[model samples]
Target: MAQVLFLGGLGRSGTTLVERLLGEIPGVCALGEVVHLWQRDLRDDERCGCGERFSACEFWRQVGKTAFDGWDNVDVERVQALRDAVERTRHIPRLASAAKPAVDVLEYASYYARIYQAAAEVSGAKLVVDSSKHSALAHVLRAAGDIDLRVVHVVRDARGVAYSWTKRVARPESDGTDEMTRYSPGRSALLWNAHNAAFGLLARRGVPVRRIRYEEFLADPRAGLIRLADFAGITLQPTDLDFLRPGHADLGVGHSAAGNPMRFTVGRLPLRRDDAWVRSLPAAQRRLVGAVCGPMLRAYGYPLNPQETR
Candidate 1:
């Protein structure tokens, strides 16, 4: 069985950064957001972590050949539509107990499982880290029962997430183009609550899950990684967290399908908190986010008021 670590949470919660850090460890391959493989990477021809277009990259070419008969036989549009129909947030609860999943779910899971198997084979890693950040997909994979799936639910303060989503950050693609992603505070709060709740449902349904707060992980990454390794049934060596230099780690190439442009980042991962929102976010917007996410925020130990918390 392929040992898979599925990152489940809302986007911009440091999933990409954690994935990269975990990838630096020996015997682990971080495949960033394989959920976007059919749509963004293959159909849109996005750049891979290794700075090459998906079709042109030798590593992913092998993955395609190994996972599917060949890349040419895969219908990107059809698969993407199927994913939208079957794997969605609203459908997560039902899929969690879907002993006999819909044909679409089964088909997608088969294709996805092949990718995980191929990744483990090609990278020769004992574990494959998939930072897909989708609770629905996580539940589907768990129901499929084709691979050993473990989840690391990365959560961030909803206020911080709302602030992060409001900012316009550019994607670091090779083409010098930018992928601008922004969300209103209200939408961010709703998603933060809903995504976390969905993942919680999976845990209730007996999925092996480890919940990690982004702030706590940043406070002590070594400890956080130790807990994660323990949950995934892997042993961590001290050398894995030993930064070669300030902000630098000896990371290997991974053909992650899609994620923040940070996937293209190699070496020197600076660990610091992005607290700009506390200083720059407007008071009304902050309060609005607090109102929407306050109950869960407090449950996760985030004070409704940023001043009282961090």
Candidate 2:
């Protein structure tokens, strides 16, 4: 079995930057956002950290065609359709946990083993990083016995994520229909709640998990990278970080907004905590978030207004 690591968190929680940083380490191949659910709509020019779409990129094309034994033949639309059919048949929240007889643990494990072999052959790295960042997928992957699995559960403050979401909603190029459709602060707050809650619950279940806060990772990338490398049993070199920059030049987007490759660029951006939600969200929206996600906010260390939630 190959060494496989998963990055789990909600969308827009700095998973891409973490994946890119990990990709720089020798013996690591970070497959960005390989969530099978979105494989159908994934376009060639779609701006992934890899700088291309999951389907059209030469790297992924090879991974699907050769490494994973012709996953390229699986037909993205067909897979997505099956998933959609499943979702249609059940409540949406249960989509993550639903068992699929078509793509059970063995099939998934075999497919990913092929990917690991492919990645190892291409990069000469012994470990593969799958930054799909989905909790349900992580659960499934862990159940697969073909790989040595470890998890890095990354978390960011709810308000910061909400602010970023608000910005994306305004961007003509952003694919944030959910954010646009549900323009309320509670959405972000609830997202924060759902992801962190998922992470915590998963971690508590005896999975091999290392919790990493985005703020802390930003403060000390080298140390963080070193710790992650140590956990994955890989050696790190300074040159690998610099050389990998060209491959990652267009890497940052969505969650990886602060894409500067230099390790010390963490402080280049301000660390405004709650202002994005406070300043940008209307009073009504703030109340909405407080009303809905307030209990979760407090449980996760965010203080709430006295009147909003009990």
Q: Count the backbone clashes (under 3 Å) in each candidate.
A: 2, 1
lDDT of 1: 0.84
| TM-scores for the candidates | 0.95, 0.70
lDDT of 1 by residue, 180-297 (tens): 5799999999999999999889898888888999988887777777788888888888777675344345556667789987888766667777888898889999999999998999
Backbone-clash count (model 2)? 1
Q: What ranges in model 1 sit over 4 Å off?
A: 97-99, 244-252
Worst 10-residue stretch by lDDT in candidate 2? 255-264
Off by over 4 Å in 2: 36-56, 68-72, 81-113, 169-183, 238-275, 283-310
Q: lDDT of model 2 at residue 239?
A: 67
Model 1 C-alpha RMSD to native: 1.7
Best by TM-score: 1
